[model samples]
Target: MTRALYSLCGADERHFFSPHCWKAVMALAHKGLDFEEVPTTYSRIVDIGGGFSKTVPVLDDNGRLISDSFDIALYLEDTYPDRPSLFGGEGGKALSRLVEGYSQMMIHPAIMRIALLDIHSILDEGDKAYFRASRESRLGKPLEDFAAGREAEREAFAAKLEPMRHMLRFQPFIGGESPLFADYIVFGALQWLRIAAGLAMLAPDDPVMAWFERCLDLHESRGRTVTAA
Candidate 1:
């Protein structure tokens, strides 16, 4: 009865980039869990089963099925409370929600804009048609047309993270002292860019860059284990 985490990967099974999936990965890592990685693509989620989920990061803990990264995190915390805590405590748990919202509201879009084309470039041929059709509908244009102006997007991303920059200047992590679910929340976004675009989105001197590196090195190179395929 081993555990398995279904991760969303690109054309190459090695390039697992879904930000939400990264959250689950880090959460499992923080809890000291050993699980097999099950790579998935957009068209393959249904393979998980009906009423369970049609998304990556679906936890197959032995026989149980859990979907949604946040829900999966909570499930892991509840199921393995004895392990190192992912949330830290009730207080950290609550603040992590704020981090999650901030990451989604401010950071996710910027990464997508800068790396959308990069992401598209890595998709397998099987996924390309579906990816293009679905994404283009929301973007109202071809992805190629949408992914222009990396410089402006990078500048915008930097400005959007000013608060995080100021915070990191004093604290080593968003969770203060050590990484917590809060750190995982934002780290997931950074992981997304790293896997999708493989682009250095930050300046060498930025505190956020330092934190990102620390995240990469966390949990015995957990973040770095998967390459952008």
Candidate 2:
């Protein structure tokens, strides 16, 4: 049987709001695939059923372990070639690459900062301590020192928004008329800003925001299903 395992907490609002996971889920739904979700704690992720890295969105397809969200998305596209194309055609593929690259380069860092803002609330005290200690060990600087750079980070993020806004204004979706991998990539980054920072990528009048609303509508219509073992 073809089986997939997703490691995620059942009650995490942030994980539910995660665009990365959402995109993967959407792809699975789009392909009409049957999969299982494995509810996991943060620490147990690295060693759930043997020695493995603790990543929440890990996909184990009949014992072949695949980690990382982007990799998982690509795997799905390759595994189920008969499904609707996520990359669209050559122009769409090119657009997807540009959108993914821009999102990773310009948007992800800011989203990371927004997530870290309330990290203490989400993680246990022990986990928080361990996270800080690990960072300190690697960087030789305190977490507080690293966190103090938030203002500059936000400003840098804001500066990049203009160019993104310009690019998105012309197209209904990042990859053109229809949704594609590029749309999902950018949506994942934007989802972080919306949920983590309570921010919007564009003004209310912007066409990009309208596209986002349309994406959300499509997401809601697809439905989410969770099964028990």
Pick the lDDT winner.
1
TM, every model? 0.94, 0.76
Off by over 4 Å in 2: 5-19, 54-56, 90-95, 136-140, 200-202, 221-229
Candidate lDDT values, in order? 0.85, 0.62
Model 2's lDDT to the true fold?
A: 0.62
Model 2: per-residue Cα lDDT over 167-207, one tens digit each: 67687766567777767777666654565455543467755
TM-score of 2: 0.76
- Residues forming the 10-long window of minimal summed lDDT in candidate 1: 193-202
lDDT of 2 at 194: 62
Error (Å) of candidate 1 at residue 144 is 2.2
Q: Extract clashing residue pairs from model 1.
A: 11-124, 15-229
Worst 10 residues of 2 by lDDT: 220-229
Return the top candidate by TM-score. Answer: 1
What is the lDDT, from 0 to 100, of the residue 50 in candidate 2? Answer: 76
